[model samples]
Target: MVTPRLRHPVRRIGDRDIDFSRRLAVMAIVNRTPDSFYDRGATFALEAAVASGRAAFEAGADVVDVGGVKFAPGPPVPVAEEIDRVVPVVRALAPFGPVSVDTFQPEVARAAIDAGAAVINDTTGVHDPRIADVVADSDATLVVAHSLAAPRTQLPLPHYDDVVAEVRDFLEHRVAVAREHGVPAERIIVDPGHDLNKNTRHSLELTRRLGEFADIGLPMLVALSNKDFIGEALGRDRDQRLHGSLAAAVFCATQGARMVRVHNVRETVDALRMVEAILGWREPAYLLHNMRSEGNE
Candidate 1:
């Protein structure tokens, strides 16, 4: 099913206002950690992270999500280190576009917001509640993602009676909590946490049924960027899953997912634009190529 078109899904994040109804936005992944499952610390250094952020924005990222630690099982990083890892990068990237700090720690989130982050893309779905408080105190946006366990912990066997329904319920509850804590409804986004604690089958189900999440009424953000679920389904590795990831991304967008958090900014941006153009939400950049000109044709 095609996404029911929205009239005005415009919302501001940090310094920019995005019209989510008309244009699909890509949130580029800029990992500051040395052990992120996908990037493997390629941008862990401060200079590298800043450069990557710039490049992603240049490549058409509507936002940059900077994370100090990977979500998969890993050694615990101290709060100070987390702050150090993300703040500089956030500051460096603030002038480029909206910056989102991918952290659940209230302290680190606060630091990033102070340093010019417009959004806190917490994966815990406000598990601590204080993280919601941090976002409530700021004029920034909050991304509530559903996850079953603490960050970096080995995800236990997932047991959802109805994965899509359960994820929608969890995100609804978290969005309500965020509103109660003073974060405006317009500034909140929801994610179903694909592959966070789910196996391949569950993730696939969620992707197929993603349209159900529109009931949440907030903009939907899907992290389908070379995730394990895609790789598992295609018998591919992380490096070989770009094609699968793009396919999933287009599926999600068609189902009303307004935002995609991805590693390949340029490719995802192009795919989303093409999808939007086909949907009549956006126009092609040029019409001359297909036109039968009087002299050229």
Candidate 2:
């Protein structure tokens, strides 16, 4: 019943090796923006962002993603300001664990890499190949995600006849683009983009059919934490969608998603650990549940 892992797995990022073949990684999001959709400025301050990253890493997050600009629309954050917002946080977090900088700008990618970020989580799906070159120049990994339009430039009534197929095709194309720009296949990861440019129905459909994306042959990443799709599907607001969010994450994990980008680090980590143990990919932490010594019922 088990399927093959990513064709090219076990890439190195920083001083660590990411074996996406069997292990699922938890990437905790720590946005430096003041108006992010979730957490809304909770980690906006430089000190606050670093502290949040520290806590997330301590809580078992495999990677801490620092983003200076919000994925949603807002007044433009100049390149210099974006660098200022995320570079420090990356510099502070890199020494302790894997750090990913979420930006589509080549300059920001370059600076973050210089600051010790090991992954470039470009939400733009390599919309600009220049950023791909930035990642290729170093040994960093790249996250190529699908978004219909540039951040803050919404696509009014974005529609897709087959969300899964379209997203897969886009990822395939972007992965090729990355390779063309010198990024190796092993250094690449694909993300379906979830609700980035998709509506609730689209997001739900993509989630339902995400396992089909394994044909793309790269380790898949899903950022479904408290997304509007879960909210709209369950008729719950952002703060009330933890259960729904975890459900979607576990669903994707079962579909062979290699990484999950999330806001609730501890809860998400616990959920993924449970999933891994259930799938027999990991041993439970000293199982005693059914042992006679433990007095099973």
Candidate 3:
């Protein structure tokens, strides 16, 4: 007979202790580019992009990550051009809720922070020194995502002696860098960068073993929404991976992800609530009904 594992109690973020036990936070992706792999041409217009951000917030997203460049296998945009593309959107969306700027360039990071973005979602993990200075000078939280190689180079074939250990090490190194730059330890979040430089197997292993990164002691953000690995796993295309994306979100929440960046917010939120119910991490309706019956008695 197999014993059921006990669910770990959800904890607060940073020393600030922000309670996240109510539900898994949803981060909606608002791509402000014409070349994004999944949502290309979907958010090209500024009005459409802002509307998408507003709609995502209405759909129960806790945060919105706005990006200017595609970052898919393509030519890189210049720093000035990237900033020009994202700052306006960030300025427009800052009043809604927590806004995150998705860029690795320091100039863009600084401009976005000035434009009222509360978080810096750096895909390159502060590879550029100026990015460190930008975060150090501001109150913005930094999300250091792990990408093995540049997207232009075909993802380096997912070579890893141990995927979990290498990813943990990379994140730990990034944390140390942020600390050295006067960015408080609690303000840092780590992401495994699913599908960024990883193949299907690497992404799967990372998803299954996400619990390992909890030892790093910072909030974990998982972006497995409609990624190609899900398509590969389900033998479906990007648009058809909705169910798979929700499944991955539930798995991430079970494995201790604090925030899930997804394109489909409502479905992911519902799936995570169900997972929480099954793990006894959340109060079950039947239990509540029984309590009401006993009260009547």
Candidate 4:
């Protein structure tokens, strides 16, 4: 039970074979939604979104998660419009490296895949099994994130008897659905859907017990960047939540989370690198502190 929780040593997302045994992946967010709670549509324009992806890749982001729809309640974006919003960014960024589309609609997932997205990041936990079928038909990865609300709908005062147990169980059920749809085991990832229809206490409990998710036997992706829970935890606004976010991210990574979805790509990459070094999974870039025969001090 104390062994590495991830069943697969390598998870092939997009064109990369992520070594889950040693590295923590950073899934950088580049939202194309004008009303995104994080960036406030900073990358809503096609060019801005593409530029953001490129910048994230340069900053050491392992995967670029391109989202066209805002997570909070919003006006409905027609399927075609959503496709129009994400497909181009997916196409532009796909060549650079692994590109994930944050969507739940089967049609949008199919379109994004056709446009070169390698991961269908369904934060809805694949409420519609057709999304699983779409992923199955392709060689793409699927992220089944646990969330109770329908896409763009609100779940007022969401409650759970035990958030961790319920979230883990939800993910297990969703993974089974994906498997039933022929999605290979190595291509499936799970996210606990922090702050998505969950209150801060629930999110914190999920974070505290995130290790329990290892029972699911798959790589875990924690999308806890700049979330309301972090803000509520430390009383910081979106832009000010970086420190709290890093703390949560590092804790989860140390506890065996394989991927962290975040807006602060470079910071996350740097922080996770330090964690990896401390965990013996990575080496220091330069060992200059005490290499000399005599101490400089």
**Candidate 3's TM-score:** 0.87
Q: What digit string (tens of lDDT, one per residue) describes model 1 on residues 74-189?
A: 77899999999999998899998999999989999899999999999989898878888988998999999999887779878889899998998889898888888888888888
TM-score of each prediction:
0.96, 0.96, 0.87, 0.96
Q: Please, what are the lDDT tens digits per residue for candidate 3 over residues 154-184? A: 5656688998899889888977887788887
- Where does candidate 2 clash, by residue pair? 73-152
Pairs in clash, predicted candidate 3 = none
Candidate 4 residue lDDT tens string, 135-223: 99998999999999888899999999999988888888889999999998888999999999999999999998887877678888999
The 0-to-1 C-alpha lDDT of every candidate, in the order given, reads 0.89, 0.89, 0.79, 0.90
Model 2 ranges off by over 4 Å: 1-5, 290-297
As for model 3, its CA RMSD to the true structure in angstroms is 4.3
Worst lDDT run of 10 residues, candidate 3, spans: 1-10
Model 4 scores what on Cα lDDT?
A: 0.90
What range of 10 consecutive residues in model 2 has the weakest lDDT sum? 287-296
Q: Which candidate comes out best when scored by lDDT?
A: 4
lDDT of 2 by residue, 142-243 (tens): 999999797668788998988888998899999999999999988998999988888989988988888788767788889999999999999998899999
lDDT of 3: 0.79
Off by over 4 Å in 4: 1-4, 295-297
